[model samples]
Target: MPDYKAPLRDMRFLIDHVFDFHGHYAGLGATDASPDMVGAILEEGAKFCENVLSPLNRSGDEEGCHFDNGVVTTPKGFKEAFAQYVEGGWHGVAADPAYGGQGLPSSLGLVLSEMIGSSNTSWGMYPGLTHGAMSAIHAHGSQAQKDTYLTKLTAGQWTGTMCLTEAHCGTDLGIIKTRAVPQANGSYALTGSKIFISAGEHDMSENIIHLVLAKLPDAPAGTKGISLFIVPKFLPESGERNGVSCGSIEHKMGIKASATCVLNFDGAEGYLIGEANKGLNCMFTMMNHARLGTGMQGLCNGEASFQGAVKYANDRLQMRSLTGPKAPDKAADPIIVHPDVRRMLLTMKAFNEGNRALAYFTAQLLDTAHLSADPDQRQEAEDLLAFLTPICKAFMTETGLEVTNHGMQVFGGHGFIREWGMEQLVRDCRIAPIYEGTNGIQALDLLGRKVLGSQGKLLRGFTKIVHKFCAANAEHPQLKVQVAKLNQLNQQWGELTAKVGMAAMKNPDEVGAAALDYLMYSGYIILGYLWLRMALVAQAQIDNGSGDPDYARGKLATCEFYFKRLLPRTATHRAAVEAGSECLMSLPAELFAL
Candidate 1:
């Protein structure tokens, strides 16, 4: 396996230039994240990820987690590394200062997360789920709940997990069998089984705080009956063991170091977090956070794989250059000289950098949504976040899977072998699209719920921003052509929505039929707009003679590659969207496999 190096230069380019993160932080009144402070954090974060976390990635995967009796133990060094993370305050960089956190901007935490994820995805999962659990409690938990759980969670004395899935249900929370009964005391007794619970019973934290969903006896039917609860492994005040216990931990394809356990809450004492019969609504608070973090996994694994593949491409000798001898001293030229190899490498590059741009841009909105005082600003940010979140989760993972495959292919036969560590990237990324509501479900949420449900209002929020950018840069000397192309797509995006809206009106199934394709199409356009924005910045830097010239030009070249090569994928998805449901529904269910 090749050593992982944090792409600090590129990360800085996005933070300092493309997104203007410094200005964003100041606007949010996060003066604590001064430019110098942000720089120091990123540098120190890189060292921790590189020296501490990265080394454990492969070894952790190989060792996996151990399940004994009812206790879940993480692989070697995971516990110590997590302790170091907490001691260094890395665990609560974005949590509220009231809860013993550093009180940094949320976006800054995401910036740090990219490195943590890229270096050791399995290890990152421990804190990753905890952050999601914290968000839910912060948004919906009672003041008492916050004082008790958030303080420990923020201080890293305890970790958290979101338990929504049961063996009988995944996305359909409506039919969950978990039950919560009220007690004479203010608490309830939760008796149910939750499966696929990451960090559910890990030994890395002193206590595991579980945010679980169940129903009261008199509650309404379906999803409306659900209620959220905080069930801990150990009673907070008395320090006695609760009824919650690990039934078993799953043996999975990848991320084996992270404990994915089946948790049985056997009359566990639980406290309600939010309004009764509104558990799904409360869970969304955590689910949305988890979805975004899951989307980052695509970028994380793709980056790790890309680093390995690119290194191998440069060092591994293969066929000679077609036209000439680029490296005559060697018996054969490096594989990177081949056009086919370049194609795979460029594809990986275009998707990784463009996806990074999209992720960072979304992080800015996250900050505005959370930190801004203005109701109108917060609402706009929220609207945009709702629209972009599904796309970010679906599109990025789909392309991320593609990127990792290409990375493996770049290594030829060596890629298939486990020693090179390229194949593990594929296995690790495989679950991303399937989990977090699956890419299919994410697509339905995007095209069906968010786009059509809003009557196109949500779609317009994002397109309006793209329209404004294109209008401002319509006549840029270096990027006018690219800007014009993005402008045309911006308009077409609205037209496509209107077309789908019309079809969905006539046949509701049209939304379901066209959803995945529509989402992929939307994703390409979104990436195109982001790539143009990045190119605009890079070109301006070149003209002004600021920053590294090669780096600036490299951005310009990647932007051009995206426009010419990958943007064409939109055409296929567009065609699929326009095809409607007739062809799909026309086939009878019984005829399949016949």
Candidate 2:
């Protein structure tokens, strides 16, 4: 099998050395949280994933999800695996403490999420969607709703899903045909058919709470008219009948074990989540969280792929070295001795470590936004979080797919086979860029709404943080070059932001065409910052002689590889973004017609 070990030491290095998790949590009044406690929790989470979940990954993928007679059956071991997961209290890691959660920092939650996703992504989706649904309800639901659902969801007794897409509409919600009618009891009668609903139906939970998006009879046309509703599989009170039922589940390309259902809601009993005719706004609250989670899935899969490739490289002996056969006693030499193979391995290592640092920093910003005492600090945190969300989701996943692909390449023929598991990593990581709003959509949101729409204020604020870090660490020998390179990239991104913003004013299509490129550029610069931060931390550890020299040396070497090899991609993206909208728009609608 696959030997999957949690990188707990590296995780601690990022938390304590790079981002200062203890100071962050202490500032938030979470004085009870000690490094020992965090370490124990992560160890337990690692064991749960390795011992309980990882063993089921291949079986779940081969069996996939099954649907018959309007009931969905998960892959054989899934139900039992999920049951064990809940019993371990893994579900409440980041939930509110008042509702039976451990209320751990989101930073810790990020590590757990990465572990679970790496172990089995399809299995990760069930609770992942549940967390997103719970976030939506917690933000907009009434006291009664919270009392009824929050505890159950936090405890994993009940699961949740967001039912947004229909057969006709996936990204554009303006044309959705799902309908809702106000009832006499203040609830609504919802009627719609939703497709691509993950975790829609399963035997793992007692009930499934669906947060549905639909339109009212007299509601305004397009997106503004949309409304969100809480429609459960069974009634909340008596566990009686509800109008919602599963028609079937989709047979997908990957993440096969996670049930994707086609749900039919015929006059389903429903209650409004927030104000009527404002569902899109409420759904975004959940979508933002879901999008981030999807990004984490990408990072997690990349990490898994790297581990698998490294193991294979160390064990798989093939060609002899060009200079001499170091293992003349053996059949051949290890593939890792090849320079090209080493390049691929180094690429995976650098991207995975950089992405991990990025994810953790984003998680820290999220915590600070909610927990920081100063209003100015909170606002700054929120702005940075909002600005980085798209980067984290789009850039991380895009690079993640690249890293996994390289990992597969390192495995040679074995990587292509399903039995070896590397192929599954590629297939599973592919979806992160497509779902949770395609990377293209994420780019548009970043350029049109977050970056240029605000006249580049948010982007500027973010760069200022990088500038401060660079200034503070100017004397650090290892980080100086990387910091300078990042500064140059940031300057170029700022200029590109202005040029694109001005061109977008002439025609909105310009924004649509260049959004993906801009997102990639931004992602590279942000990762550069993460590399610099990690390098600084590793240098400190080495100077103080506080940890193993090899580990610290490995960290510095990865940072060097990132700066030398991967950071150059920013130039290509900058050029693409600067090419303007003509390349994409020049293709006429009739060009493809025969």
Candidate 3:
């Protein structure tokens, strides 16, 4: 396995130069997160991840989680590492101060998450799910519920999980068989089994809080009847074990260290959260957070694989360079000298860096949405978030998967070996595109609900921002051609949406058929825009003789590579979208096999 170094130099570049995060923090009223504090946090967070978490990654995977009976014990050093994580106060860096948190901006928390995930994704799951639960309770839980759960969670005294998937249902929550019956005490008794519950049962935290979905007896049918519940492994007041138990943990292909449990809640006491029969609405608060975090998993695995691949590429000598031997004294040139190897490396670099930019930009929007005191500003931020969230979740993961695959290929046969740890990244990343509402679901949500559902208002919310950006930078000296290309693609994006919208109005299947392709197309454009943004800043630094010119040049070069190579993917997706639904729908379901 490659040594996981937190990419602090690139992180600093994005935070300090590209995004101007200090100005952003000031505007968001996060005065506590000043330049010095942010700097200190980044350095400290990097050290903790590299020195503490990274080392345990391979070992954790090797030992996996041990489940005997109902108890799930994490791999060696996991419990200790988690304890160190909590002691360092990393759990609540972005939580509300009123709830025993440091109350920094959400973006900072996400930055830390990138490191945690890259270093030890399995361990990160313990807190990743907890943070999502915190968001849900903080947003929709009752005051009493908040007081009971949020404080302990923020203090890392307890951990949490979002339990929605059942054997019968995954994305379709309308048919969930879980039942929540009313009790005299105003609480409900929840009874059902949830599958694929990450951190559902663990020894790392004292208690496990599950925000579950179930149906009440008096509730209506389908989704309208669904309700959210707070089902803890142990009753908070009594400290007695609740009826919830881990029936078993999954023996999975990857993330073996993270306990993926099959939880059985047998008449467990649960408190209703938000309005009755409105559970899905409330759970979305947590799901969205998890979706973004899942997207980061792509970047996380990609980064780890890239680090390993790059190191191996630099060290592994193959045939001589096409023109001449770059290393005459060393038998043959390194694989890094090969064009195909460079292609893979550069592809990883472009996607990783561009995706980071997108993640940070979206994180900034999260800060705006959460911290802005002005209602209108908050609403605008919320709209942008709604539009971007699916793209962030779906697109980043897709590109991230591609990046990891390329990284593996760069290692040739060694990449496929278990000892190198590259294959583990591939397995770990495979789950990302499948979960957080499969990339297909995310695409439908993006094209069907978020875009056309809003009559393009939501889509406009983002494209307009890109418009202003392109208009402002239309005549750059070094990057003018790329800017023009981005501008044209931006215009084409709107036109493509209009085309799909018109077709979907006549046939709703058009939306489903075009959604995945449309989303991929949208992703390429968004990344293109971000690449341009970073390139513009990099070129400015180069022009004015400020910052590291070498770093700036690398940014510009990567941006060029993105435009010339990856951005062209938009054409293929666009073509598929224009191909329409007939080709997909013409064949009967039974004909698929035949």
- Candidate No. with top lDDT: 3
Please provide, for model 3 over 463-565, each residue's C-alpha lDDT reduced to its tens digit, 9 standing for 90 to 100. 8988898889888778889988988998999999999999988999999999999999998999998898898888888889999999999999999999998
Per-model TM-score versus the true fold: 0.99, 0.98, 0.99
lDDT of 1 by residue, 96-186 (tens): 9999888898888998899998999989998999999999999999898899899999988899999999998999998999899999999
Regions of model 1 farther than 4 Å from truth: none
Better of 2 and 3 by TM-score: 3
Clashes of 2: 0
Q: What's the lDDT for candidate 1?
A: 0.92
Where's the lowest-lDDT run of ten residues in candidate 2? 473-482
lDDT of 2 by residue, 1-594 (tens): 366788888888888788888888988877656778787888899999888888888889899988889888899989998888898888988888888888887777778988999899999999999999988988899899999999999999999999999999899999999999999999899998999999999889999999999999999999999999999999988889699999998878889999989999999999999999999999998998998899998788898899999989988999899989968889999999988988999988888888888889899988887677889999999898889898889988998999889988988888888889888888889999999899998999998999988889999998888888877876666577777777777777788888988888898888988899889888878888888878777788899998888998998898888888888988888888778888887889899695
TM-score of 1: 0.99
Candidate 3 accuracy as TM-score: 0.99
- lDDT, residue 362, model 1: 95
